[model samples]
Target: MKKYPFVYLACTAAVVGASLGATPASAGHMTHVVHAGQSIQKAVDAAESGDTVLITPGTYRESVTVTTPGLTLRGVGRGVVIEPAAAKAAGTCAAGGNGICVVGTKERKVEDVTLASLTVTGFTRSGVYATATDGLTVRHVTAVKNGVWGIAQEGSVRGVFRGNTARDNGDAGLFLANTISAEQGATDTGGTLVERNRLEGNRIGVTVRRLRNLTVTGNHLTGNCAGVFVVGDENKPRAGQVTVAENRIVRNNKSCPKTARLDALQGSGIVLTGTEDTLITQNVIRDNAGTSPLSGGIVLFKSFVGTASERNRISDNELSGNSPADLVDQETGKANTFEANTCQVSRPAGLC
Candidate 1:
């Protein structure tokens, strides 16, 4: 990964200046109203650090980039739409290409924004890309028909994504990648809380890679190719300590060819690969039946060589109405517990 050198320089300068007893006071708050013939970027450029850009109800054909810290861009109503300026710049003829891009450092918090009643669509990549931000709250946002993920966050810490609706995206509805380089022996990413989000009709509802200390709770994931996929490998050894609890995973079946039988099909309630030391509790995994026979309610595949999934708990889950299988496979690693689960299909008459 290419290190953001200018960002590092800016952060270092800010830290040193802060250490020299020159503590920078919080920038005063301001608000800008976006109007016709005025671009969103121009408004952002004119506003100070801790300002709010109130976008009026209109269709704005622009791609906005938010580099300012502690800023909240709010739309008045659902009519506020931001799309790519032109097709050539984003390499796609879609209506909206990469809706809002946020790049911030560690010092500031991106908070208190109600991104509601707006429709973000037709992005070439992701609808929103938030990088290196903290305390960022994305609530009640609607992302639809994007080429890639609806929402993507990389290296973000302490962010809350709640009540957001993501649908018909090419890849996952919400993609959270925590692959930041360790600085000063501390990981800059992780500690994110994703809850109460509605993700449907995407390739995957949620895909988390190379993350730790993530809490995905109370999210409704349905009608996707895969409900939730947790992937880790030798390269990402520390992708553990994640808590996947209280989420409703259901009906994530995708149609596939008949030749791929006995292979876990596109729809899986929860697919865990090389994931260990995690808590999978109180989730409702059901109705994940697709055309392929490899489909299962919950699957645990060993992706890493010589690595086994151990000490993981799968309890109190209502696993029923799944295709191909209802529970664990033989290849899955051992020492995992399956207790108090209401499985429609099981080995013995009672719970195993």
Candidate 2:
């Protein structure tokens, strides 16, 4: 009986050793090479868990969706292109197709994927949409000439948008909206970090609504309709706090003459309405020319909440050729503080 037990142990050890030797150390890191005549969706379909689909440099004229977790879709260099069929559609284009969408139920990540180093254009809706996903990172990417916003994120949490360039989009460069119903109120959709991005020539540079604990810093916003528009709903009990600091917001002077009543209503470098607990500090708000009256450097109007525009410690912030001074339209029910601001332009009373 003792001899039989020893033989069995030896046989089990040999079988385990053979299995380990046959497999590579990083067998989990499988690689799927995507080439010509292969659809990008097929490569994603063939990917197992924790696999990386390495796409070689080519023009791929198809829209892709990522539903798998821990799967990385990377381009060889910067020539990986996915052009849609039509210019604009909500989810997909009737003329062009849709762009890449990450619609994972669990948290997923998509990184190091370049969009338009070789001219991938013609999409409706957005170039990239990260909906109901978490930990999605879009870095070192360029999205240009899209139908709507360049990058749109809805119901996404803990996402990072860094080193991305968005230009000539139909709407805002980056549109982030948290439209959870009141019954599903305040679902902590992760804190969004937007930094070091070049957002220009869009309808709006960045539009944020119904979010919490957002930090937008070190970005360049120029030649858009509005630099940064922060809006919220008054009926909601939860107040979203935003920190806008150390950004260069200049020359968002697009005209809307037909909406002269609207233009004369609200316009500025940083436009805020119905938002609370916002910190607009250390930002260079300069040369935001308005098409009509009621425009200035940093304008806050009709905000029935509390904000602190102090210690923006604004200095050397050149406000030239703008009709009004640095701060304008100090209304009721909104508490704000303006301190240490240097403005060179001339304005009327109560606009300092």
User: Highest TM-score among the candidates is held by which one?
Assistant: 1
Regions of model 1 farther than 4 Å from truth? 1-27, 90-97, 105-117, 180-190, 256-265, 291-294, 304-307, 330-334, 347-352
What is candidate 1's lDDT per residue for 1-352, written digit by digit as tens?
6421111011111212222221223445545656545677767766565666666667777677777766666665456776666535532223335788776666654543324445677778878777777777777778888888898887778778888889999887998876433411113344788899999999889987767778889999988888887766555454667788999998898643333312434768887666667788888888887644336787666654544565667777878887656665534466766787778774323443
lDDT of 2: 0.62
Q: Write the per-residue lDDT of candidate 2 for residues 173-259, one digit (tens) a residue.
A: 887777533322323445678898889888778878667677888999888777887666454544357777788888877653334
lDDT of each: 0.68, 0.62
Question: What is the alpha-carbon RMSD of candidate 1 to the true structure?
Answer: 9.5
* Weakest lDDT window of 10 consecutive positions for candidate 2: 4-13
Model 2 TM-score relative to the real fold: 0.76
Worst 10 residues of 1 by lDDT: 4-13
TM-score of each: 0.79, 0.76
